[model samples]
Target chain A: MRTTLCDRLGIEYPVFGFTPSEHVAAAISRAGGLGVLGCVRFNDPEELDRVLDWMDDNTGGRPYGVDVVMPAAVPAEGSAGDLGELIPAEHRAFVERTLAELGVPELPDGAAERGGVLGWLHSVARSHVDVALNHRIALIANALGSPPVDVIERAHAHDVPVAALAGRVDHAMRHVDNGVDLVVSQGYEAGGHTGEIASMVLLPEIVDAVGERAPVLAAGGIGSGRQAAAALALGASGVWMGSFWLATEEYRRGMAEASAMQDALVAARSADTVRTRIYTGKPARLLRTRWTEAWSAPDAPAPLPMPLQNLLVAEAHQRISAAGDPSVVSMPVGQIVGRMDRVRPVADIMGELVADFASTVDRLGTLR
Target chain B: MRTTLCDRLGIEYPVFGFTPSEHVAAAISRAGGLGVLGCVRFNDPEELDRVLDWMDDNTGGRPYGVDVVMPAAVPAEGSAGDLGELIPAEHRAFVERTLAELGVPELPDGAAERGGVLGWLHSVARSHVDVALNHRIALIANALGSPPVDVIERAHAHDVPVAALAGRVDHAMRHVDNGVDLVVSQGYEAGGHTGEIASMVLLPEIVDAVGERAPVLAAGGIGSGRQAAAALALGASGVWMGSFWLATEEYRRGMAEASAMQDALVAARSADTVRTRIYTGKPARLLRTRWTEAWSAPDAPAPLPMPLQNLLVAEAHQRISAAGDPSVVSMPVGQIVGRMDRVRPVADIMGELVADFASTVDRLGTLR
Candidate 1:
């Protein structure tokens, strides 16, 4: 079952699991695929280092990687060139006003003093990347676009694969041109930042585009072996699993929150989900909770771009996270959430995937 | 533009367009709410005649009604049912061979030619209420679910309304219920059959589910102002034309294939399109050219379910359509093709819709 990507990543299956928790990452890796720790939410270098070390000690030398969110470019004409400084009082006012209307109370005084940094953004992402590369990371996958030349060079120096997630083929080609070894074609069905295309179509199109030039892994809306077999048929070397993991027993997260996510899964309809900047500063697919609802309202303020959106909602997210209010929190899950029926073990998922793949291949052979 | 659908169909904008020709239905009502069409593809004769004729002429002096392909209900309890008799031996052989290769084909030439039985399916559709009656034909709508009892009775009793089309909530929920006046939510981007989603999110979720509820007027991708605005903001009491009409000064079996529909505006993104079947017996968005080279491949089978997977190749749709060449025939035209650049007239479509019903009202007030 060692596919091209599995061989390259030194894993049994070419499954790449993305998660913020190191435990989940390590679990996926130990289960015979690569687990790329989502470094986007890691607040600081020191914290990431601890988590990486924790993963290292737990995995017993299993290979893993780090995932970042870096775009190839933003409005070069700079409509938002000065993204941070452009945070006018008006935009902040909009956020403030929206929170109030949505019944979101003011941030508890001294909330920041209690725990982590108030938010996660580009800068935080870059710093975390630096931290991961400094560690024994074997690969660096950017969630959005091409990694900077320096990051590409640095990873190459360490002999680590540098990969990028792309919503479009042009973006993947750009990453490949910039020396990216792999590209995860994250269609709209994936957990976070995505393009409008579904994985069913995007995977094959991208696979065709990156043939030999770069190995493309299918992401978004992938959960079962049928979907994976579909992806492979479309030409993806592997699958990047997200929503499925959230349903895994090995996944570490607020149990209640995961339960709420379960509720979301059952009620999951395409219309029930939306692309919004309720989380981070980009267009991401999230559960349509009150938090996202308020943002989507007619009177709601125009959401801040990328990091600003992340900053504005961080505290509210933290509040909801602590309060355990699913409605008020941004639950980032993909359309594939519909297929996640129960919380199972990671190894169990891998086993099912392998069996399904073999069976699908056999079934497909009969057709031929 | 204060055309009350109720006034038009002697009912209200709550009309339905259920004709296989989405653009035609969209155009009628967009000029101030007409009958809905685009249903028969489902092939259910729940109320075939009453639904079809009612859908064709119902919109109370306004256009209404839809037709869907409800062809598969015959195989009840795992039985091929009556449709088996419809399948000629040669056609049956093709299916056996095709299934031997994949699932089913959309427009099997032999099956199409073998269709005295399938045409009888149309007769099944034509059997609604005995006549168009007091229910003025405002709009017609159609889908696969057994035709609602009231759809036939109400449209007849009301003196107007009708609708049809397929594949999603946006298209599925015809303004409130089966009682919709007229609507058609097909997603063919440009043409031929259609797919599972996208007529711009299935015409504003079927114009909040059926047009008459609020005169929901949207097409697969109508391409003009009157098209974009009326349906989107100003109120579709105006237009919804498809890409087919874009080059047709006069409609002749759907305008001939256009050269490269890749202009930036229309290139929206491949994701914007969906592939489904309501035309033949499959589900395939219209993105290919030349018998789609794809359909000719070895591993190109195992399509999804009824009216969907078969739509994948639409049964070598071109084989019979390309001057009967079995190579270049593409069918069905949705609103998405408006991005095709060259303009003809329908009156002048090759056009386009959306909704923010109240805002358009507010904009009108401002203009005043």
Candidate 2:
């Protein structure tokens, strides 16, 4: 289960867990894998700073990382309030109508309106980078692609390596050329935003294209140790997993609504997912639910681009989560949802993955 | 590398090579892997009989298999002319217009017209099965799913095993329940008709569901020994590879139009493909070319259902191939196209796969 990436990232195993919950990330770090906290959910820098402070004290001295969304082109800079105004009225009405039709209840009075998502904005993502560099973080990753060159230099200045997620070979090569220290070959079957290439093909292509320059971590459809071993066999330095952690006990503890999402994921098979841009204006694999199915209708309005789409749907998403219906909840998950049959402690999952990886390797050794 | 499937199928290795060319199938069988010749192209039973005779004599007494397209619901039985009339005039005109736009010249005078593919008719497929059973075929596989129980029993009566391709766990379970002896868990990244699950997730799901009842062979995005090793790690008894053999020297030697297809495939990246129903009535992965692009236009007619769609495009495909332009050639290929950079003998490919599998296993064994 060891590779040069393990030594370089100062982790015991080659597993890198990505989650939005600081609790889950800290638990993963404590469990000997690098737990990367996704910072895209934090709309405020102070909020991210507070979370990082908590992460620093709770990780048991293990290294962890932070992920931010930095689009290749810096989008039009605006506050969430201004971004909300840019969303078309028809799109907003469609979202509201769809939510109401799906029987999603409105938020309670005096609750915060989760309307706009400024987290995907370039300025906010830059703030995330600045805050992440201030912490004792071991790595910083850009979810979209390679961050700007100066950002890489700034991370390097903090002695923190920068990683980028790539779905194609040219993207990996471009990431390396732009000074990224590591490449995460995120496949088409990955949750959130993804490229069209599957991990089995994209991993080897990217590894051969960029492994000489930077270590390649395979992502997408990887839940078990056998899949992790496959990643290694395909020349990935490790596995970058996100969906499996969504079902972790730590995840359940942080997000009150995650139980319903976990139930949805646990009940889903590998084929019960669709890649649609309705999630965030970019194609993302999400569990096939009533919400996603509604958008597939012929008359449904097309999703807005990027930050606007997130802004338009943020409140609807809040309602869906608050409604707590597993069948209609909007959740991004990989096809590996079939394997996340139950919730377990992060340590137990990590132990099982490592054990299974070792046994799988041993089993393969007997083939000839 | 070997598994129980190797012994059961009477092959030296667990590799299952699938191709439409008898030359390539014989070469694969002679090289120690089980070569399964695709029979859907043989509209005439006599033509298929001739090929089987060639395979029997050319395979050096090695075991081989035959694949037929016996759809679960038998398609309408008709002569090619009867079915040809059922296609809408707009669809036919669109095909002709597309060919004209692509500068694909019509067939020369006295040349055979390749339109109206009766091979997809249920009667033709049943005839293929009848002919294959009379030969020394070691296995019979259904490309669609589990053949009718009678078809399975018919093969079993001859002591030959029946294998079916499945993309989901339930499908694999159903296949096994229907008396299929082997299940090929073909993934989303596979060529031709495929399901939505990627190989990494689908392989393990199917293997776990049906491995106790039948062996599972992983198919999709597998081109090299490393991917085959990964499939074994994922619990697949063997690798059912089709796309990799498309670039072999034997493949090049058989079809005069194959060179353009190979050139298109060799120049393609993993992302240079689209899953569309234009090629067949069911969704299939095809190399993204002008032909596919033309069909994707907003005003283009929707592809007809399976056998009808193939009939509609048969002549267009023929003209495109005869035009000998790689850029417009319509070809079915998996995402592994990026790995097929050159032509090689089937023996060379098999040797490389075995050597790589051994070295990959050995490499993983030393990782701890």
Q: True-contact fraction for model 1?
A: 0.03
Per-prediction interface RMSD in Å: 20.7, 0.8
**DockQ score of each predicted structure, in the order shown:** 0.04, 0.85
* Residues B129-247 of candidate 2: C-alpha lDDT, one tens digit per residue: 99999999999999999998988999999999999999888888989999999999999999988988899999998988885899899999999889999999999999999999998
Give candidate 1 regions above 4 Å deviation.
A74-86, A89-110, A113-124, A253-270, B1-368
lDDT score, candidate 1, position B108 = 43
Off by over 4 Å in 2: none
By summed lDDT, the worst window of 10 consecutive residues in model 1 chain B runs over B349-358
Instruction: State which docking tier applies to candidate 1.
Output: incorrect
lDDT of 1: 0.54
Expressed as tens digits, the lDDT of each residue in A1-368 for candidate 1 is 34667667777788888886677788888888888888766556797888888877877687999888666664212222354455677766776776666666666676562232322444556677778877777789887788788879988988899888988767878888899999899876567787766554456557767889988888876766655654565456778887678767666452444555555555565445677776766788887777777777787677766556665555566656655444665678776655566678888988888776666454433222
Name the Cα RMSD for model 1: 20.1
lDDT per residue as tens, model 1, B1-368? 23344455542333232334444454545544443444333334444444455434533344444443333244221123443443345433443454334322345445453222232143444443223332334433444433455545665566644444444654456334645444445443435555534332344444544544645544544433322332333123333333434333332224342322322224334443435432345554554333333344563343434423232323333333423331233434343442344434343332122232223233322221
